[model samples]
Target: MSGTSSQGEGSPGGASADSVRRRRVPRAERERQIVDVAVEVFAKRGYHATSVDEIAELAGISKPMVYLYLDSKEGLFLACLHREANRLVVAFQGAAKAVAPSPELRLHAGLLAFFGFVAEHRAGWVVLHRQAAELTEAIAGAAAEARRAVMAEVADLVRAGIAESGPASRLSAEDADFVAHALVGAADSLTDWMARHPGRTPEDVTLRLMNMVWVGMGGVLAGRTWSLEDPGDAPH
Candidate 1:
């Protein structure tokens, strides 16, 4: 009968155990904390050089616990990729959606968000942009998927712009797709350019890009065509 009563708060050690349990982080939060630390380490050292032990130590958790939560180093890296990629997509989508319905403004907002994310979350951007590609097929696939998602968003905006131009607009859906690929590719390469030119704000980069691309796009939509035959039209 002495051990019959449950371990209530009055029981010796019961209150402390209860408190510890209460203080224990939720699984999702704990995983996120580990991933946060992992992102920084992986960004600094890259995937090949980064160790799970380092990540665990930085996270204030044991190495095995990191493995337990994320399954393995690859899994942890994959988790980082998926999270950062989703974050980038969401930032871009959110900014574009929050803007006025004009496709030019929407594209500008989305691009500003993308550049801003790269500037602010440099570690995350490095992980997603630099680290994901050279890994295993699954990792490569994830990176590719992220690229496709961004491309799709850009394509949709281009398609809208083309539609709004009415019958005078000469571009088609294929043109939208082509423009999307060009824009996404240019943006990817320009991140390096942006790194070199820190003085340029995201808005500056976005506006420059808009002028470079959208001005040409506007001309194209108005049924303008360029050819080598026209030498006088070339810029001095």
Candidate 2:
């Protein structure tokens, strides 16, 4: 049975004539491989530095294969961003799920979930947070969408905190946004800093952020006086 017939093809029943003809991968698995390679390439070379050739090489498929499945380089990077960002969002949402009915606790769980994602998938974070900054057009929009999606959850928490506690509402939506941005910035900066200082546990970083944001947010929204700690009154 030569390779001509659809019966026997490769050596001794190893490859069917039809199999040798060309096995078609399911769309889902092919998409997964494309995304996996895209993540690695984008993470390693940054988005601008990566090429479809590199992804194809890493994926052991033709460049056209990637294009066929994921369109262009921008498309591939965007897909990776969407997949990874969605994963992080889901993780944070899951964490917020088991929260003990306190906005404070939910916020803490959300922080924990975020750090856990950042730690486990540093590459994903880099692509979402770093590489996205370097891209333009639709790619940049993907980043914005992801950033907004994540931040919206935080903002919603803030809104809830206001409604439940009744004081945060006094602050304009702009004021609420300002507070959300500050808390987000502090958490992100601390996470980056925690990565630099390996001696400081991430959990410790998370807790430090938790205490700072939760106390401040809770107090401010609960209408408590804003307490300024003296430089002399705090731990180093």
Candidate 3:
């Protein structure tokens, strides 16, 4: 009797034994999966249009399961925004890591990364672009914080590039700020347009930007422009 009872208690078929071996998802993994599904949903249909139920369904889990993993729809959306913002920021910054590259190349790499991210993370980028209404205070705050960080980095690069180009005694602080904002604004607006058009490649967009701004870009560094000397009048 004792042997039989002990065997049954330790058996793999027993409820307690099954509980011990159950494969419950870790909090991080489950949250990641929830955010992944939420990104696609929010991207296709703006935040207001999305529901936790839809995300749950798309994620192959029950609604209650989604809540258990990520809380309410608002909470889930915020999570998605947070994840994507970090990813994009890292990508853009990483592209500028080449040491001692020219401002033009640095600018080129940064713009390429920006456009590449928007093209790659379609849902995540769309959520950031549109769905302003769906963003609660928390999400909006996080988004603003991320943008400020990127803007600061861009401004720093602009300052460095200008300095390298030469003595820009004319360019004011406000001028630098304006240029920084303009580049960001143009990239973001064009991102939306490029996404919709589908024909314009990322390189095409980056080249167009370089041509438009680079013609006068030297002014940013030297605060002035130098004219080509007449070869015949060689200042010997």
Candidate 4:
């Protein structure tokens, strides 16, 4: 009787034994999967509404496993934000590095990269924006800092443009700063618009923006200023 009981306890049924033998995923891969699913869920349902259970279910892992990897819902959300934000920043950096030396061309390349990222990772954008709305001392600070870095990059590009322009069109540091901030704001707003307007392609959005921003820059660079006093001569 003792021998028979030992055999049953050791092996259980075949199915049960097979489940117990299932392979465990690597820690890094598991954490990545959890964050990826969390981004999707958090984006679809705002951060406040999302749950770790849902993320775990979507990721084919246990809730306890998610906690084991990410600690808590907030941690998981932060991880998602970091991952996506890093992706966007890297995309911009890579594109900027690959482009021509012209400042305007570099700016154009960055805009194209930015729009392309939004088009491909809409969910990521939603999470990042949500981070802005639900600010906290810790996670929100990180998110804000990430944005500031991108804005600073834009400012650098603007400064370069100012230097490249003719003396008449060149702007002071203060003016360049203002223009950089304005350009960043416009791009952010347009990204939201693009998300809602599925019919528009990233390339199309980039071209329209170039027409607005680059053309205006061209006027200033050409030493032409528009004013009510002289409604600039009509285009030929």
C-alpha lDDT score of every prediction, in listed order: 0.87, 0.75, 0.73, 0.79
lDDT of 2 at 13: 53
Q: TM-score for each prediction?
A: 0.90, 0.82, 0.80, 0.85
Encode model 1's per-residue lDDT on 1-236: one tens digit a residue.
21212121123454555565555666798899999999999999999999998888777666767877889999999999999999999999999999999999999999999999999998999998988999989899999999999999999999999999988988989999999999988998889899999998888988999999998898788777676999666432
lDDT of 2 by residue, 1-236 (tens): 23332231112456655565565456688689879878977888887678898787777666766777787888888899999999989998899878898777787888888888888888888888777867878888888888888888887777667778864446556766776788777776776786798787657777988777776665566555533775454332
Least accurate 10 contiguous residues by lDDT in model 4 = 2-11
Q: What value of lDDT does candidate 4 attain over all alpha carbons?
A: 0.79
Can you give the lDDT of residue 148 in candidate 2? 82
In terms of TM-score, which candidate is strongest? 1
Q: Worst 10-residue stretch by lDDT in candidate 3?
A: 2-11
Please write out the lDDT profile of model 4 over residues 1-236, one tens digit for every residue: 43332232233445453454454456788788788889899989887888887887788766766776788888887898889888888888788879889888888888899899999999998888655447556678778877887888888888888888868775688878888888888989998789789999998998899889878877776676666776766232
Candidate 4 segments whose C-alpha is farther than 4 A from its true place: 1-22, 227-236
Superposed on all Cα atoms, model 4 deviates from the true structure by an RMSD in Å of 5.9
In lDDT terms, how accurate is model 3?
0.73
Q: List the residue pairs that clash in candidate 1.
A: none
